[model samples]
Structures are given as structure tokens and as C-alpha cells.
Target: MRRRPSKEQFEQQIEQTAKALHDEMIAGKWAAGSFLPPEKSLEARFGLSNYSIRLGLEQLVQEGWIEKIAGVGNRVVATRPQVKLTIACENVTLRNLKTSGAGRTISAFYPWIQVEFLSMISPIPGTDLSERTLAGDLVLLDNVQFQQLSENRLTHLLEPLSEDDEWYPQFTKHFSVEGRRLLQPIVLSPLVLCYNKAHFRESGLAEPNGSWTWNDLIRHAELLYDGRGRYGFAFHIQSLYRWPLFLIQSRERFEESGEEFLRSRSSRLLDGLKLCKDILHNRKAVPLYLSENNDDINRMFMEGKLSMTLNTYMGLNSWNEAEIEYDISPVPYMDSPRTLLITLGAGINGSSEHKEEARLLVDFLGRCGRERESAYADRIRHYCKCCAQRLP
Candidate 1:
């Protein structure tokens, strides 16, 4: 004596069957583009009515796992959609990073999800984000980009993650909004003066130190400059990381005066700009083409064609790998020793359909290898030492 199931019970059965199918698909039981079993077979296997089988396949269809052909059977679309993570990085490819510490963490924790990186990034203008412009499921944003995201109300894309003991307070604060974390800091790099030791020794000039001022730097650069192919010092004058020190010095000076803050900003910025312009135009200490890129500067430094350059921890991995003999000191400034703190963090896209999965990836990356004994910790330590940052 068999009893037919109620409509609600049938629907529940459909949901369960759909979930099972989804799990199997993720487990690679069915290859992508392969057709599912016939409707009659599905009905017989699940012991469900024809309607229930249709409903279950429809569920899979909605989840992007399968595509329904009008007259044909259901075909697999994708077992898992690869999450796209956008990075505004230079000189490195996504393939190179995917097998690193964070990449291994993601792979171990999320065996089913794949990650892809898109690096070309353009600034979002006027505090507005068009979905067309933001083309990734997750984005690695810098401080400036974070400010833009905050202004444009796009930070809602970031999932709020549970803070762990491994996170450094100073680094975490950089990505926090109104006490809420918008992203998790994965990298911390401070601006520093990376000078070629051999060049200073060859020029018979004192190497740069914390006490050195901008004037001192310029003077040493002039002394080191050879009238031939070699340059004394090099850096991008328009860089936010290097140029802001001048503004900070100006602000300190104006703090003791009666000038308004905005007025101070304009005047101080111009003063900073004038200083940089003079270094290029009048002093002729820097080459006109030094602004080409850090690649050119790094190449020249490695080749012993440049004396000093302003850089951050981001340059350490390459420099160390190249075995370039060099040392670092705090960047020279006018009023006090100042450097910009650069942070790299990861955030999820709010509109992503797979938000829960994205959150898992973000969370794992934030705490992957911060422990003392961990292999990831060893890697982090190596990178930190290269950058001369204090380990937490």
C-alpha cells in the first residue's frame, strides 16, 4: 500500500535531490558540458514524480550548474565558477602568485573553487562605481582605492570577517571603516630609501641614514652623479608614497602657524612640488626619464648605474632574488623622518552570487601563515626581513 507524497514533501525531496546533484557535480562526478541522465532515469533513481524531477533539475539550472535545452536534456555548464580577483599590481602574473602561501591556503581550504586574477585597474572617478568597470568577484584594493570605494559606497562589497589574534592591530586599522573591517591586510610595506652601498662607497660619500634631510640627499646625489651614463639618484616625483612626506613636513610646519588647514595644504603641496621640480629641473640630480617605471630604476640600480632610490618592501622579493647588494634606511625628509605605509588587502564583491565562498577565501588568506612555526610563517618572515619590517 503506497501513499503519494504531499506537495510540500515533494518539493522538499526536489531540493534535497538538487543539493545532491550539486555536490556530485562539484565532486567531478559529472564533467562540465556533459549531459545529465534522462528525465525518466532521474525520476526512477530518485523515486520521485516527473514533476519533482523537473523541479530538481530546475534548481540546478538556477545555481549555474546546468543548462536546460528546450527539447534536449540538461547539460552541465560549470561545476564551480572560478572567482575572479582583481589586483592593481605590476610586474607579476596571477599564475606566479596562485601557488604561493596564500594560494596554497586557498587551494587547501577550497578544493572546489578556482581563483583567477585580473590586474588591469582604472580609477573610479567622482565617487561612483559602475558595475561594468569593477569586473571581478573580489578585488585587492590599496589605501587610495579603499578611500574611493568608501566614498562610492562600494565597500559594502567587502564581507565582514571575524578578526583573529594573528592580525596586527596597526595593519588591520588601515582597512577598517567606522570600526568595522572592510578588508583584511595581507601585506604591509613602508616606504624606505633603498641605496646602492657600492655606489656610496665608490663615490666616497656617507651613506643615507635616518638623520639625513632632503637637502642632504640632494647634495649627496649631486656628488654621486657622474656626467656620463650613470645617475646619482632616481624616483618618481609624482608618486603618492614618496611625495606625501613633503606634505606631512609642511603640515607640521603650518600647525605652528595661523594659516587655515586647506591653505596650508595648497601652499605646502606646492612647496613640495617645487622642491621636486627643482630636483629635476634646476638641480639636475635626477634623469628626465627616471619616471619611466620602477622596473627601469630597479634595473639601473641592479646594474650599478644608479646610486639611490625610494622604494618599499614590495621591491624586496625581486631585489633579494636578484642578489642585488643594497641596504635600506628611512627616507630622507625635511622636518622629520616620514614614510607612507602601504597596505594590500582583500575584499569580496557584494553583488557576487557566491558570497559565502568568497568570504571563506578572504578569511583564509587573512590568517593563512602568520604563526611562528608554520611554513607560511617562514615565507612571511623571509618577505618581512627583505622589507625590514618588524614581525608580529
Candidate 2:
């Protein structure tokens, strides 16, 4: 006399039920030798039908949360999951980042979703035409790295997310290809001015705020420079992440490349480029030594080698526990007020056999990422399929 449970309803009940029981078990929830509460009690407690309760219990068994005894009930078999989840990644983003706040959260929470989270990441992949990108159950890439995989390749490699628009509308849709979603965002950060507060206090210069401009920053840099070991401000001018912000804020679609482009809104582009060049060559503004990459900038900033540098939230993980007193502010803009926002996201491999589990990871990260940073992850991906970005 019970009605049928819809597939959607059944799946939701199962996922939620498993997560709840998993939490309880993790908290030393069960009594009588870690035996799960009676199925009838679980059914009533979770508002799930008897069939739904059994299905939820079955998932836990499959996930190695418990073992089913003959004729009695399900009992704890492994305190930790015996499953190993493989995810294709880049070593720099995850392995070196475990010490950061966001990175630490990810490292800690990865076990919450699954105990044996195995990662085999390639440091840098070549762009050989014949070379194929080998993958596992999941792959994570930022917007810039996503370009390494061609549009057709990305389309073939990723599947549409089960839950569309689970994060911010802009980020949610950023992973779509040809109106079909291909990934979900997990973490994001906007470019901000990371500065040493002590330096500003020592020099009697007011800390930078939202109203700072290029000229203001340059003038302050001249003052902050000690002419001994430290400089005022420094960032890698050659970084793909740093250089592009100049052209983007210049505010032109930039289809034409000749004088026509320069005559258009591209004049701002020239100004932006000039500023970058001046900053790089400005002896009074930057350090004598060159910065190789963003990591170098972060390290020097933490060591008090420089007063300020442009960085993203993800980049802040390096200094999450640094003993220095540092704060972040809006990056000084040129003619237009804009900042480069970056996001790192996860996608299920199109051909992965364990796609359902991958979806669970995507969903779990999507839900959890919102808790960590509600608004900054994966803000740019599919929006500019051809790399022609429109202001967000």
C-alpha cells in the first residue's frame, strides 16, 4: 500500500541519509559495538520509506562504512574507507598548498568525503599533438590551465554537471561548453593588494584602501622603498595571470590588431602596458632582483623583502600561518576598475566508469566550497570559450 518513490527523491534521500549516518558514525555515534541503529528506527528518524532506508544502508556498505552480518544487521567493518579515489591534478595546486587555509581545508575535508583520496598529478604537461592526457575518475583545472586542453578536447573529456548553477550563476555557467556544462567550481580568489602592514606603519604611510590608483601606488612605492634590501611594491610582470589584467581592464573586445584597434578603446591598453613596463623598470618602486613567478613574489613578501604584491585568495594559502602581519586591499587599477578573478574547479571525465561517485565529489565540493568562499571560485571558464572575455 506504499506509493512508489521517484528516482530523484530516492537518490536525494540516499545521499543525505548516507552523509548523516556517516557523520554520526564518524562522531562515534553508534552503540552496541558500532552497529547501525535498527532499520525501522532509521526509517522513522530520516523520514525515509523502509526501501529507502535499506538503500541508504546499502550505500554505506558499498563505501566500506560497515559490513552486513548474517540475519542480524549492519556493523562497523572499517573505521576508514578502504576505497581509493583517483583524481588527475597538477602538483603545484594541491600538494604544495596543503599548508594554506583553503588548501588545508581541502586536505582535511577530502577525507570527510572519502578516506583514501589519492592524487596523481602531472607537474607540467607538454602540448604535443600526438600526446594524450591520461585521466582518472576526476580532473581539476583552473581557467588558465583549462585552455591547455582544447575546446574539442575539453568537450570530449568532461561531462555536464548533474546540478547546474549550484554555485554562483557566473561561475556555475563558466564550465559549460556549447551550452552543456563540463565542470563545477570548487575555489576562487580575486586579485588583491597583499601588503606588509608593518612596513606602512614603519614609514608612516597610510595603508592602501579601495580608492587607490596607479599614481597613488607608484608614489607610495617610492616612499616605501628603503634603498637597502626592500622595495615598495613588486609583482611578476611576465606572469600570464598578472599581464592579462592590463589588457582586460582596458575594456575592448579587441578583434582588430592594427591601428584600428589602437584608435578604439585600445588606447587604454597602451596606457596599461606602459604602466607595467614602468613598474618593472622603476628602480625606485620595485626590487633590484627579478621575480620568477607568483610564488617568488609571495615568498619575498612574507620574508619582508617587499612591501606589497598583487595576489589572489588561493595565493594567500602560502602565508596562512606566516608570523608576519599582512593585510589585503583592492589592487590599484588603471583607467578602468577591474581585477582578475581566478577559480579552480573539478570535472568528471566523460569516459570515467565511476561517474556517479565523481558527481558525488563534485556535488560535495560545490556544497562545501560555498561554505568556504561563497562567491569567488570558477568565475571564468566557458564564458569566454574563444578567450574573448566580457566583463563579469
Candidate 3:
């Protein structure tokens, strides 16, 4: 015995089908001014009868999303869905973005799409990241948090990057979780050794090279130590950004549990910490008051009180502004050349109603290569690095 849907049930099914198609149209599945598939194809696609398909199309026609002709198929009337993409970010990050001209750039890129930037404050204090993304169309997360979003299924797994999508492999790997790419990297900030040229020249020490090891760096740092207010090496003592480089350089993965990592190379970790302490306290190679504040370190470096420090590309902005004579080099390593990469990226919220618009905004922010310079993306292209392969 088989049961067929009643008239009311059939009509409900048609309404549901209509809503699905309408959402698809709103999602930019098909271009506007183009005809929808034939009724037979629609029947197969939605697993509904031909009458249901017609009813669904008629429903959409009433919604102004499509129009049916006498003999032809249903024509799409609206291509771009009217959606305001809401980007959630921290206050400082938002300020930096505004200062960097992100808003004007995105507006020029997608004139039809509306964008809204929201300061992401927890509903309650310390609600954490998962709760934050649930309310946003797009979210800005650092590399570690971005991976958490993908691992926890909080982000929409984006489509595969095309051949033309330009990104550095080194940076891209930091954002990839499992098998899918969920985050669109917007900034490139990597940990590096920032050296003061004057310090090296005064000490008669040659500039650091890739071949330099941790021992060589320590030696050079000791040589440059003037035993006065000046220091050979200095870095934020309690900084996550700088400490992780020690673990990475030692060919160890970061473990939330210190027990596991310590069992193998407890001495190495101890040695690393001891080295920093000796430089700061015993050797007096670093200013004693120097702690975990980057701004203070940046100020000290700018004042020519420190020789070398571990920093990122962002540090350059301050140094460049101060016109400090500094050059960057790869961080010295113990076993392997490793540097901690810090990046900020955007990912679409899985349950967002404005996925298409959110995607467009993220893509615009992350776009690279030559074509982007010619498109609306050109407005923000100043933030990106241009090369001979791409046109200005």
C-alpha cells in the first residue's frame, strides 16, 4: 500500500519548493534576465510534480523574484539580492581597518551591496568566539581562532580557490583547517627579527643572515651589549607572538598541555626561557624594566636603546614613522627555520542570510593578482603588494 500527498500537503510542498528556489535566487545561484530550467528539469531538481513546479514558479512570480512568459520559461528579474553584510570585529581591529580605508574600498568594489561593520562585543562579558560568529555575516579572526572556527564548524566552508586566486603558500597553510579553506586572509603579518643597523655597525658585527643560528644570534647580541642603558637583544617577555617562535624553531608543535611537550625537551624549553632571563636580568643585555608591552618595546627601539627584537610587519609602521634605521631578517632557529605567522582573516557565518554578499565582501578584501587592480577592487589595491606579473 502506498500513500500520495493530499491536496493541502501538495500545496505545502509547492510552497516549500518555492521558498527554496527563492532563497537560491537570493543567493545568486543564477544570473538575472536569464530563464530558469525547464519544468521537467525543475520537477527532477525539487523532486516534485510538474504542477508543483508551475505552482512554485507562480509563487516566485508573485514575489517579484521571477516572471513567467506565455511559451518560454520563468525569467529571473532580480540578480543581486538586497542584503547588508554585517562584519563583526574587535574595536581596535575595526579602527585599524577604517584607518586603512577598508570601508571606502569595499563600497567602491560592490556598489550594489551594502556593508555594515559591527564592533564585536560579547553579549555577556567573555562569551567567546563561537557565540560572536552566530550573529554575524562575516567575522574577523586571527589564525589560531580562525582554525578553531573551521574545526568547530562555525564558518562556512568556502568554494575551492580558482587557479587565478593569488596567495602565498606559506601564509595560506596557516589558515587551512583539515581539508577545507574557510578563512580569507586579509593581512600578512609574520614574525621576524628586526635589527638596528647602527647597533651592528657600532659593534663591528656583520648583519644577520639566514645561516645564523640561535647560538650565533646570542653571541652577536652579547657582543652588542654596551653594559649601559642600551641592550643587545630585547623582546616582549610574556608575548604569545614571540614565545611560539621558540617552540616552532625547536621543531615542536604547540601543545595546550605543557606535560607532553615538556617530557621530550623540557630542557630546551627551560634553556629558551633561561636564555631570555639571562639576557634581561643576569647578562643585563636588555633593559631591566622591559616587560610584555610591544608599544614600550617599539618606543625603546625607536629611541635606539635596543639592538634587535622579535616583531612583525606591523612594527614597521611605527618604525617607519619614526624613520628608524632598521632591517628585517628571518628569526634565528635552533633546529629548523621557523617563524610564527600572525594573520587576520574573514570567514562567512554558516547560518548567515546574506552569504553571497558576505562572500563578495570577503573576496574583495582577500583578492590578489592583476585582475583585481582593474576591477572595483582597485580602490583597495593600495593595501596589497603589486608586482610585475600584475598591472597597477
Candidate 4:
């Protein structure tokens, strides 16, 4: 008699089956919203038992590759697309905040406040959170202009802000002064640097060894670029924070001794800028600044045209969706390894009559993970619970 499949073997079989089904869905062999083949038939096709087939389909469903109806077979609800949750706040540690008794009681007692995904401005596609307020729901809110939280409010505010031109100034100004006391902020995940490991190996370049410095990265780019059609690197201008990180790593600060604007006398800062300019101009490492119309740096990287780029954890989903082989590593560092940290926080609206209740909900949403944290994290790489201590 044939021996039973080992647990590892069964897992491999399930993964292979899921990939085949996914490929079929992608090729239009199975139309979207159409029911997938029955478990028995798939079992026969893959030469597995019905139990194994169900296991594979369950895996697919969890990965958001398909959905199961109450009476209908599994249907291709949607293809998992890459989603990013950009959060902004003041505090920099990834730890949980302690709430007082008044805060907990307020949240537990509120009835009108509900937590739900707001579809109007949600960053992910097809994922809806339109409900007013629900526990463990991800909501996106910007800074309330000309508004202040009450001193006795005891509320948490979660703000996910991107480092955009318009928002960064407001965020810096808001958090530098007002946010320090009122809000607690933490980066949910480390900044992720992803590159095509296969491409690097094929081009006779070493796979980035987990950590690298600015000079090390430059050398690798120089060696990888050969005046050929292939380019050494490509990055979105929006991710220009990497430039400042280089300065920070070199023990240089952006602010002057007593001024708010960035300092100009730091020779190290000037050197880093000159290096970037050289890479852009002389080395021809990166393409000339393309107009917004044709500026899909992620797409270019996915097409296997570039060797490396600096991207956030959320960008990993995009690479996965594009089916390009890649690996994640910490962002390049300088003298001492460091990443420019960004975080989101929850706060109460001072004007709302439900201010007390809102504070409770904010604390629960920001700190509670029993229900919503995993689901959000699975959908978006950056939507992590503040207290999740696992290092990645």
C-alpha cells in the first residue's frame, strides 16, 4: 500500500494546486466571478484526495485568491492587489499605549460609535469600510485643520499620512508641537528594500547581504550598469526620503543648529547629494526624470529592467502581484544602521459630542488586535498592530 503523504508533502501539494488554479484564473481559463471546479474534479486532476483539494481551496480563499458562497462553489471574487496604508504620527516606538480606566469604560459603554472601513477614501481596492465606527476597523483620516483635542479627552487618534509634499509639512508642524503630548505613534513595520534576486545573480552581482551602506550600494550599482539596455536602478520620486536617510546615517541632521529649515554647511550632506546627482547624470545609473505620464517605476522594476529600488513593505504586494521573483532586505544604512521611521496614531475629534466615546474607540482600534489587526495586515503589508513585536 502507498504510504500516507507527510505533512510537508501535503503542504507542497496544496501550494502547487493553489498556484495552478491561480494561473488558470489569470489566463481567463476561469472567468472572474465564475465558480471554480468542484473539489472532487480538482482532486482527480491533481491526483489528490477530496480532503487535500478542499485544503488547497481553503488556502486560496485565505490568500484572497477566491471566495466561497453559501450554496455556490468557490468563485474568483478578486485577485489580490497590492495595498499600502500610509500612517503618520509623532511617537516613534512600536509599543502599546496604556489607557486609563476612564478611557476603557468610555469605549465599552458607547453605542453610537461604530468602527467600519470608509470606502470613500480607502487606499485598497474592493476592500470596503464604509461603516461609521466599528471595533477593529481601519479608518483613514487626515489632520483636522484649526482643531485641537481637549486636554481631558483621553482619546487616541490614528493618522496614516504619506510623505507627500502637501501633507509632510502639515504633519511635521502638527506633530512637532501638538502631537508630542496628545498622541502616541509607532511604525508598524520596517522600511522594506526589495530587489529581484534572480536578476542580481544573473548579472554577476551578489545578492544584497541583508544590510548594506550607501557606499556599498553605489559600488554595486556601478558594477551592475554596463551601458546596455538594462538599467541599474529605478525609484519613484515620492520615495525621496531615502536621500535624507543617507544623511541621517552619516550622523548629519537635516535641521540647522538653531534654524527650522535644512542645514547647508554639512559637508557629508553635500557629498550624499552630489553622489545622487552623479548617479543620475554621469553613471547613467537611473533614467532621466520621466514625466508623470510615463513614470511607473514599480512597473519598470517588475518588468525586470532595473536591478534595485527602495520601497516600503506595502510595495512587496505589488511585486508579488506582478509575479516577479524578489527578496526583502533592510534599507541601506551608513555609519550606524537606521531606518527613517513613520507611524500612524488615533485621536479624538475635540468638537464631537461623543468625544469621550471616540477616545475609547481610538485606543481600541490602535491597540486591540484580537479581530481586525490580522485581517488588515493580511490585506496591506503596513497595517500592523502597534504591539506586534516580531521583527521582520
Candidate 2 residues lying further than 4 Å off, grouped into runs, are 1-81, 95-134, 256-266, 375-392
Candidate 2 lDDT tens digits, 1-392: 98877889779979999988876665446632567878999988998888888888889889787888978988976455533455666555654335234334544544433322334444342132111343657777666666555543645667776666456666756666667767787776566788899999999999998678888898999999998888898887766667777767666445566777658554666777777888878899887676666778878888998999987667777676798998988778775467776767788877776565567667766777677663432332312222234222
Residues 237-347, candidate 3: write the lDDT tens digits: 666556656655544444557786667566565565555555566464656674646767878888888898887654465554666688877777666555666677777
Poorest lDDT segment (10 consecutive residues) of candidate 4: 86-95
- The alpha-carbon lDDT assigned to residue 57 of candidate 3 equals 87
TM-score per prediction, in order, is 0.64, 0.71, 0.65, 0.48
Model 1 per-residue lDDT tens digits across residues 1-392: 89988878877899899977876775557888899899999888999879889989988888788999888999988455554444333223232233355555666655556665555334321223444445666666656557666777766666666665577676676677878887777656567788888888877888888788888988888888888867778876655556665655544344544566566656765686577667776345677674655567778788877788877665566665655578988777666455566666777766676665666666666654243225445434433332322211
Q: Residue 349 of model 4: what lDDT?
A: 35
User: Which residue segments of model 4 deviate by more than 4 Å?
Assistant: 1-180, 184-187, 226-228, 238-240, 256-266, 282-284, 291-295, 368-392
When 2 and 3 are scored with lDDT, the better candidate is: 2
Clashes of 3: 0
Q: Residue 23 CA error for candidate 2 (Å)?
A: 18
List of clashing residue pairs for candidate 1 = 157-350
Mind sharing the TM-score for model 2? 0.71
> Among these predicted structures, which one has the highest lDDT?
2
